[model samples]
Target: MASGTSQAPEDGGVMPSRAPELLSGNPDVTPDAIRATEKKKVEAPYGQWKSDITKEALFRGSRKLLSPRVCSRTGRTFFTEARPDGIYHLVEASQSGATYSCHTVLPEGYSARSRVYEYGGGADDGKGDDGDAGPRVIFCNFSDCTVQILDVDTEKVTCLLAESDTLRYADFAAPPRPGSPWVLAVQEDHASAVPDQVRNYVVVIHTATGEVRRAVEGADFYMYPSFSADGGKIAWVQWDFPDMPWSGVKLYWADWNDEDGAVSNVEWVAGEDGMTVTEPRWGADGFLYFCYEKTNYRQFYRRRPGGDMALLDLKRYEEAEFGSASMFIGSHTYAILSKECIVAVATENGSDKVIAFNPETLQSQDLSLPLSEITYDGLYRLSDTSFIVIGGGDTTPQAFYLVDITDNDDGARDNRKLTNIRWSIDEVLNPEIFSTPQHIHFSAKSGPKREIHGFYWPPHNLEYKGPEGTKPPLIVQSHGGPTGHTGPGLALSMQYWNARGYATFAINYSGSDGHGKTYRELLNGRWGAIDVNDIAESVRHLSSSTSTPPLIDGRRVGIRGGSAGGYSVLQALCQHPALFAGGACYYGISDVKLLLQETHKMESHYVDFLLFTPGMTDADKEQVMRDRSPVHHAGNITAPLLICHGEDDKVVPISQAYTMYDDIRARGGEVKLVKFPGEGHGFRKGGELAQGA
Candidate 1:
């Protein structure tokens, strides 16, 4: 990593004397009611404007609605909802006459969450009709970290797999046979001889006997244990250490023996070292469907039972990705609708949209969706033509919708006929005060000289405006995952700050998804340096030279982010202290070495590919890591810093925060550290979020 500081001038109490440039994500749609000068408005300085949005309102509306699981037999869709009160509920949504309703179906204190890879996903699966027993969902109980089954209708809890201190299971797959006793899942054995050497394999769980038996074993990691329609064969994906799921994986199919639980004759179907294989799904027609990248995009592909794997049709839009860089198990980018058709989440240019494909003919088209602009959390195949998906757009908050394409013609692709039911829209959002984010692309100042992607939200509130000729204070956010993307979605946090007359720019940086694989691979072996330089460039690009009138006050600019993003916040403050006035880091990495030891099993080796260059010796890597570690340079960061960490976080341990705080405070630097108890890598409770905000 280079020790060079930014050449951009420092923020020496110099206020930018021009109005911030307002860029709209939607320029042609509606008249600007937020900036209507004719309306009487409260005049105030930037970053201090007052509006209806408050911390209480911002967090009260925040709910984690994800992991949508649908039961075809019961016509009910299940979703995991994490509320501010700290109870994680398995919410069931079913359609009534003209509307739909969602309510919790899980027992009290029973949360439908997974802890497999430490950053758990793939914790629950719903299918099978158990006669008078009704629909049931099998999930990993977060309380004891065990696998359990819950009867959806009766709300009865049954133990399928016993609790284990060393074993964790996720990405469950149940046989298609009604009332089948067998289901498959990816099981992780954490009781390895070497603590960090967590072993991963597949197992078959006997629902009737409450017994878990090994089915398949070999890979360093396993995911999506999908069974064939007839339950004779199974298909799954596997990857090894040093390669993230998005980097490389292999798909395999095998024979399943009913007499004794075992998977045999496993054969590699697809995937290679450079390619990424997503959730392997078995269509009703017995074809295995998945997404992988051979070129620059993760295109769709499917394999027939005894035929070679072939690419599915993208309908001439092959440049877009049919799948995403899925980080967790049970992540669905596409679902097998039928042998003829499949509905998938296609990401293009940093936006998510649903694209329906004719797999046999290799043709696809954009679905006529009401929330057509942005879709996330993947698609669930409920029936042959109807699938439940979570989608939203620039003006739309993320909501649940049951898309029924059975009645629509191929040409119209209409969305009005689609069933959009009840959502987590408890808060009434006034569109007049919401500041829309406009997509902005700028060049990096150093290292590679490529385009960087981000969104700019100009401060907007119908009731307030900044006085005179001063621009707004900018919050340049570095999103988590570092592999994550920031788009123009309706975010209450962004709006709350905007209502307070604070301009914000969220940069996708170099390694963000939705872009091609080439762009995503840019962070390979140069995580902190590349991402930090991009952050500095984001402030420099928007603060002065690029925008005509300059969209922000360079002197009052700050940075905030969490997880990997928090790491960037620290690096941004340390590497380019002059560019940022302050920084807020939440559960961020302080020392690269600490991260190597403290992070979870799934992301343990991720640092190797992200920051360690190929062929670098262990000693060489350590030297490089120490150079980039924020803990080593805390004494040099003069900017006021706020560090927040969940005490229960297993990913980036709380020790990282405490260590950083002590080092910085020992050097007489301005710093504050706050801990949220009973929280994990990310804050879930409303009060915790509000306090952190």
Candidate 2:
């Protein structure tokens, strides 16, 4: 990797000073009044915020925060940390059972390839510094895989799969494929594959020969490949264009043709089966276990060849959403971490039970960590026993952890941190006054089993406790993805707001992940309904109880969100105009009908899944689209709203914001429109949009 010290001055741009500070509460809203209202909101059956604050507190604690340049895996003793120096360093400790070492591998002339995407490699150890033994990596540069590999000895580029779009490390093809080691790479080409040729082929590369072999091709798109135990085959999931990977996809497999030195006999494994198979893996015995969503809930399942897919262990709860956790990568099974017998990350029934199952014994265990809330990403296994986990929940930033399975039998254990991820954010956060979040859940309606989950942070002061006991105002936040879940990860944003004296409520609405497929699908065909209720329930929770965070003047509540969250914000304003006093939306979907027509090729048909319509006809599409569109109902939105968009946005066109602004203004609604040229669905050109948005 080229030295990044020279480039740090340019890439490490200084933070801006004019950032908008978070408001603690309404200026006129007294602390005493807030305390009184809290009790009322809690006593009122409709108020859910009080319980939310209490629950938020349940999931709070210190978390690891690291730089964005690196990624970590579970089960690995050490984690990979990408430095501003343009190098990825492998750090491990013996207590975790993985050795630590740094390798400098970069291709020549790369002159500092952007560290946009880099993932760490687990120890294969004997391979040597030059891609022989040490750590391996799988990363992607927006242009290609060039940013992923660098020569440890020379810090020079060693392996660059320029032809491949992205690369990710999977459990070594079990038993190790002979001749050359194999890793999966998702590649795209305009030609070659048939049926549908949008993204082309899935390539399996031979590390020794630099030979790239096509495994499977011809689909709208595919990602997340896993190797079957025998090393003779591969299993992966595929979904077509316009459909988000989570909505629905098909699982597939292919046999290796040793003589041909490539993949042959490609076919979908139970292709038409009505199941959403995610995180597929093959156990040592060759049984395929994967998480599947059916009947509105996501559950893990195992399948033996020629046998039916059977559910392993699962939780069916209408009150508590399950399957909200996302598995960035998967292995055959998770190693036990704490003596508590929890799965560490994948818990069953909220208990930390050691799940040793029959070939069909599906057991679940919950591993409660020090933090009350958490959001984890990538998983890695080290020496096939220990585990390393990445990504932290709300209070924690992306940190790497080392868990020794051997210690699980004893109740006394402390998972060691290989690096201090918190160091990165400590300078920015005021530790003394940081407020912890409380977790809470509430029923969506009068008697439905469905519920919403969220964490609420109450206002705090450095010196003054309160003026004879006062409560703080609150900001209800609806998370992005409309499909994504709200994990217990700490955010500078949340702390910044809390320090300023405002309480913030961030909720995982009905369709959010963690609660399984059924809850995940609640938003489907009912996007406007469930999402709206989830937010309202949060407000009710806050306004009614002293046990919860204090509420500001009911007339002064405000809301802000981006993308799907932005859509929710717009929806809230239209459906409950008096609920939020002000709203800010960033790249939110403004028009359901327009989004269906103008979305990127990768997600062109996604609206069909959410809106519950084929979207095949103009009239049918228009009706459903109009029903959910906030823009269509803008005339009724009385709250003042700030709209921000990227000029080049394709996910949700910039025009969506413009059209809404024009219409709202035409109808005498307060609105602000901000536009950035040469931008896309997301902001990339620094804080320009952040400043305006």
Candidate 3:
């Protein structure tokens, strides 16, 4: 929904309230004879009456998030797990003080003939009951992954727990242990090879008697479950495979025996003390916490049951890195909501900070604001001083922020601001205003001062004070998790090439993500030689700037991106075809050896760690994926490309931009392609490929 805008919506929306009297075809036609016949067929490009600044004035000095639904102090009748075809309604706080609302959680031909998936609150089912008064649900149904149950005081579905065809990952648990309602599920034993060759476990369901009772297979590979407070026992998470869950993982715990309700001794504790733990939970005197990331920097731990896990900011000059641009740290503990207080989230590399902590005197304050973007979901302790904090970021959107924490965390008890979802971008379009980005560091043609994170914007209404100093055509831009990066924000095609004047830039190079882990493993096996020498050393440091000397037009350079920044914009335009003149590629991937033979199945073995051998040898990974393909050097491409695609893309497949558009039009070059239709691999739909994006 952020694809700049294309205009549609006249009185009832999607253009047509007599289009300004049919563009004055003649009501005696004379709004200066219909703007002199639309300025003789359309040629007002010069300042075109100026003033253009609104999308509420570039979002009113925007730090964004002016409200679009978010409310859950847990009382809106607590319980929702993504719009499962009907039955959703949070409506109650709107008056701009906004709270939350949704209505249809199940009830349209009963959600087009039921069979939903991923429902919630089985919360590691052991079936608790201290104060428990009704309301609890769970769902799953890839037609037959079966395990449904619902009962928000009669919302329906009430039974049927396990019917597994070998279920896969499940949840629910962590409260005051009263044999609390359990339902964990996770199954295996049906291998067809691949997906790390198979071996998975965890079962336990009991949702009030659909019993299956026990099955916690081990020796590595349990699958994220989480519970252990009162629901007797059951805490999950395991890792194995080309390691990802951030390279290392583990965290176990099992005990629940309430007679024969299952679970049994199980162990492991905080990721086997080797580090790299992750989510965990437990708190309120029980002790557990989580998030480790070995030493590559992620922090926060606690443990304590038998005792000795500690680490909370163990000081390397008190280092801290919270969340953003995620390659890890999606959760960092702290959601208690209250006893003294706890609402935490703290990432210093992708810049996030919602703070509040206490966890019994660990003390910290901060509560977000000052360029606000706090995204820390889950935490709902209604009183002892309020709390909600659901999450929102990057110009904020996912709303829900009740906050009180015994007041004076300063945002004046941050009362309510949660518009009931469905958002609007005022039909998007006033973008183009960039300017703040300069972080340069250079020096790595292979060496290593290597700090490369870029930005540079400039170019609207062109002029660094022109009179004969006209330079603007740049573009550069490139980012697609070749481990990911390129931050700061506003990207309406870098504001339509900065409002048609051009000059863009982007960078983040050498395996991005706020520089850590040996500069992100220096792009592991050097992804296309460290992003073509970090975009040719950010265009030779802006053509050797000395206080912005080169406002770019180095002979009109250009290059665009998508997916792995369209494989670093077709390997930086076929490895510098005399420094780019035009490039566009949206669904990028001109053959990493046919992307390791047509990808998917979660990157079928991820080109054996991004380049070769998840089973290589198709003539040595198709000549190293056609020597890092750009349609194998589309006859040394003379630039002017464009490409873009979607036609139901399943991630870079419109046959990899129609095989780089029939190999750059059979090598005559100067491509074009375009496509779009129904859209996927993410362009998001509306029409005419949302008006050509």
For TM-score, the strongest prediction is 1
Alpha carbon lDDT of each predicted model: 0.76, 0.52, 0.51
Candidate 2, 1-693: lDDT as tens digits? 000111111222211211112112236558897566545432211112221112122122121222122212222233333342223333332222233322223333332212111111221121212323334444443323342454333443454454443332322222244333555655545332231333535676665565667677767655556556566777777766545556556777777654455776666664333446665656666666666665555555567666776765544322232222231322222432222232323432221112222333333333333333333333444433344445543333334443444334433323422332212221323233456666677666542468667777776534333233455667778777667765555665565566555678888888877666666777777787678878877787678763344454354577888888999999999988878888989889888777766664444565566776444577775677788898888877988999989887766789889888999999988899988786666554433433443
Residue 625 CA displacement from its true place in model 2, Å = 1.5
Candidate 2 residue 606 Cα shift, in angstroms, is 1.7
Reference-based lDDT, residue 641, model 1:
97
TM-score of each: 0.92, 0.72, 0.30
Off by over 4 Å in 1: 1-39, 193-195, 368-376, 406-410, 691-693
Global CA lDDT computed for model 2: 0.52
As for TM-score, the candidate ahead, 1 or 3, is: 1
Candidate 3 per-residue lDDT, tens place, 247-346, comes to 4567777777655656678777765432356666665566766666666665666675567778666333134543222322223224555445555555
